[model samples]
Target: MSSMAERRHGISTPAASTQLKLRFIDRDEHVYFWFPLLAGLSELTFDPRQEIRHSALEVLFDILRFHGGSFAQSFWVRIFDSVLLPIFDHVRAEVTDTTTFTSEKRRQQEEQWLYETCTRCLQHLVDLFVQFYDEAFTLLSRLLDLLRGFMNRSHQSLAAVGVAAFVRLAVKAGPIMNETCWEEVIAALLAILEETAPEARDLITPPPRLNPAVAAAVATAVATAAAPISTSVSSAISSEITPASGSGSPSGGPSAHHPPTAPSGAAMANGGGGAAPVGAGGRTFTLREGVGARRLAKFRCQAATQLLLVQGCSEIYANASQSLPPGAVRGLLDALAFIHRHAHAADMDMDLRRRLAVQQ
Candidate 1:
């Protein structure tokens, strides 16, 4: 427990602990001593007990963080191929299963822990020993797929963690992450925005049912009020009441009016105003002024803010911008425009919004 706590918080270790581990590995020039232990720990990662698996991952992460490069490239490759790859495979299978567990709550808890451990281990490995990444391209591809799967999951918490991990991986791997991976991530985030957008109708409560006698009286009152409109300019009113079409509000409910596009400050570089430019995927997602639009703008702004932060803090975006596929940079630009256009609409801290606007 104490060791686990120490590892979790990254407590500074004494020279003895670090030296002893290095000395043991150095003494075992053949790696006969460490290989079996690594295998055992890897096996423990799949243990039925969450604590055991978490503890095993903690130990492995610490080992990699402290002395990962000490081993030969081939040794690390073997660890990735034999140990990490299998764990990713298991995670994929578990995530795909549609079967209902006897104790769903417990299962969800276990799955969350598994995802957390997997993400942390992968991040640590990539951060500490990126030199071996090219050699492990196959494994890295699988890891990316696992991350995409996590992001596509219905569970928001899991998906949010997946997004963070995806960003971290991009920041760590830089040029190594290909365009296809970036597209997948961008698509997933857009889907999340669409899914989470709130409907104005959903926000508004329906009026309480009136009493039977009151309902009749209300209906009569409405009929009498409509009599004058029907008598005058009936044809004009009929022409104005066009059937609802795609240009109208979304299915969730009707809005008083379509939300306006983002402000000029949020417009895409190539676009003149707040109109949503087509993304790399050939989809145009427009921002409006209604509740749903505001909700979506909030999410889009937040996602873009995080991406921009990663870009500024690391070389990933700079490296990626040079090799970006057609429409990719535009998609990113659109996100940035949304952030700026609806800067005031988003329910975010004014300081943060100001910082984002300044970046724009």
Candidate 2:
């Protein structure tokens, strides 16, 4: 009995002692080895006993990978309910309402930890809860709301990540999803994804932003501007009119002021036609092609959003690979890639919208 009690302190065995030693953090910048936090959290998830395991789960500051054999495979509701849900509520409260605290220093400190821990735990729960999407709809829905909270408050990184995670859950939920779920979830993801990729800061801040990488990705690809009108729109209303100047009357001979014709095939410039003047030898450029275009101007106007999504997807795969086994990364990569593909489809929708505007 005495030995068991002592083991509970993480000192009875060499491995337990080492784990405890790893958790001994002083908050001193130099002595900090944050990576051990990963191992400790990993153990907490895989611990054999349910009660001790749940307790262990509480102190974790990071999520463990259950993708391969790394972490034990199991439905983690008891741990999630006993350890995660309450902690999520508390962390959420701490980061929210900066004014609730008396001092700015305290508020900022709380905000930093709150945001960090919030994200870490969120990823953990999401990774675990995903398998049980049908059974855990309520928990998943609440989590989606918590994630959206970051977006509502201008937490860009958190918001981007949260939206992406939520989208994944919704897709997995299949027919279980509803219209309200769409509003609470999918719409936000589309809105943020549409923002100018390169200027995430200009990309109208979602509720509270979340994932810095995603925001950075956004800044890398997109910008705020008019959407592309259409891929098939070869020329404007007045573009193909040729270089002939409008004549006063039919009796008048060829308009004197007009040149014979645009200098050869001077590559249609912006101001080339009769009403408008083409640039650089009466030839200007415009986008009239689809995805196949070498560099679609409509796409350029977005600041390369597709590139940003691909990068984010890559990051997701890389991060998951580090913690997960090869088998697990495949599903995660597939899901994230799906999100990336959907974002591209949304861009095409923007193209359609632009074309419709030009037509009307």
Candidate 3:
């Protein structure tokens, strides 16, 4: 009976039937119809038509709802290698048919679809990074460059959430690298953090007081992450991070970078990316002194505001533990540890927040 039902739902793909055995929805609650859905998503990435591509993205995103704590460990890498990477490479080069001079309206519409679609996928990827930071460590440099390009002036509208996505990834990625390398990422984040912070009400008001708790996380990330490989970030960035949209591609110029990822979240400052300003214009900004309070507050996770905050956010994963079918959580945890290291800075005030965190 179950086998017949699986076939009716289009869950019986070659890959799913062979490797996955049963549809994620049918076989195990731990992984809902993962076998068939995962297989279907993998195929969608290679579809030649834009419409097909869009549909595939949507389905994969829908499935991501089932991915969370455990699912991340079960299926993230399969998506990364089999689905994301391939689609990333394919979509990197936007197909331009000379005959199909897509009108401005058409182009804008397509871009909008892509933007929304990417956000969904990117968010899931963020979950993976948070769960398995180290698994996604090799992706840090790539992610940094990606954020800059996505949030830059080129794609102003799309960049809004794009910037947030970058922040989450940075928070997660920063801790996985060795000390020296980690600083590089943090330096970039500090610049971003500074930009997001309100202008200290005439620069004399102690610089937008920061949360001792959050500062600790940022401090930790800067303190850890990345190994010193004598290579320049700019150079490595060229090879590592490719914008999802063939960014900076001058209509007919160079191709943009590609590595399709999940969605990210951030708060706008009337707003913001990269590099610490030298000497802070004769001022000082260090871990000892602490970053502004507003920056710390962003990731604070208001337990109360959870309803409002998650309103627009599609309830993808029912519980924090039920999603990410397989092997994904490891990646998220590794990344979360990294982000915690840098963004939280809560460590510095752990003794204090410890009481708070414990209460929660």
Candidate 4:
């Protein structure tokens, strides 16, 4: 009766199936109706279409849940190799081109989707290992390698997510992570924080101001020195002006032309410029549109990434301070101190600065 019920639900009961089909879902014998029907799902998980790929992952998760530890160890290993590792590679490839999206909103949406998907994948993988802690311990070193790859990404959003995920795993693994693993984790986190630290001038410095008297005197002197140069430039332009097709000069003599001129003061100050000043090597320098805004955005992103790192570092320290060796604790403290000096110098949000301060 039990065997009949198991067969009805399509469960692979050992009683009604050969040992080979019952253990390895990949077995050819399982292609028939009585099997668990997982054929081609692994291939589908790597489909080029996003919807298909997502659906396949969802189905795999469901299958894992339904099996309730009934699957063979080899089956789990196969999932790790084919499904989990490949999904991670796919995610990295997708995220590498995230900035290529022309629209800000679209880029943000895609990043958010990737973050959620990556988080879900990490959570599921870690939870699986946590369930069989003793047996799965060896596999987690590879998982740490994956986490390190994510944390090392140049994309700020993905890096933050990686740091958060790594911190969670580190805390969960606790003493399970050997000394070398713990050292590597701390080293990686500190390197990221150091790389992302904001420059002091960009954050903390104010623009210089000039007195009214000094400004007025400077302007008068510049205008006086520039008057003759301006006249010479106008003469040069009139001589060089050429007729455009049939639109000859009204008077047919260089059209009495005067090309647009730079401000007299600036032209003379910049050493005989007709339009604008040129830098060394005759290269013109122009401020790009929205450069300040772009720089500010970049600064904010770096700050945010650093904030995540700091928080993760603090969490790791809190979790393992007692258990960590004295040398490890000293290294963490040095990293934290370095961050404290640099972060306080940067003009970050008061609340975040205070959090760092308090954590220190």
When summed lDDT is taken over every stretch of 10 residues in candidate 2, the lowest stretch is: 200-209
Deviation from truth (RMSD, Å), model 4: 18.7
Whole-model lDDT per candidate: 0.51, 0.42, 0.41, 0.57
Evaluate residue 48 in candidate 1 and report its C-alpha lDDT on the 0 to 100 scale.
75
Evaluated against the true structure, the overall lDDT of model 3 is 0.41
Count clashing residue pairs in model 1: 3
Among these predictions, the greatest lDDT belongs to: 4
Clashing pairs in 1: 259-288, 259-289, 260-289
Candidate order by lDDT, decreasing, is 4, 1, 2, 3
Residue-by-residue lDDT tens digits, candidate 2, 1-360: 866887677556776555654222223441234334544554454343556545556556333333211222222333444445665555455445554655888766555555555555566566555554544555655576565554433344444455455544444443444445444443444444444333211111112222444444444445644365333332231243333222221112222243223222221221222122222233322233222122243234344443444554455444433443343345445545555554454344332233223322
Q: Mark the regions of model 3 whose C-alpha exceeds 4 Å error after superposition.
A: 1-55, 58-81, 95-100, 171-184, 187-360
- lDDT by residue for model 4 over 1-360, one digit each (tens)? 887787789888555576534444544553243133444565565565788868976786677666626545555555577556777776777775667644788778777777767777777667676665554565665777787777666567677777778877767776666777667656765666666666422321112223454446446657788544355444443443221111122121111133222224433343222222232234432222233234455666677776777787789789967667665677778777877767544333342233223212
Best by TM-score: 4
Residue-wise lDDT of candidate 3 within 212-257, one digit each (tens)? 4444544554578745432443234333221211112201211122
111-140 per-residue lDDT for model 1 (tens digits):
676667666666665565455554444455
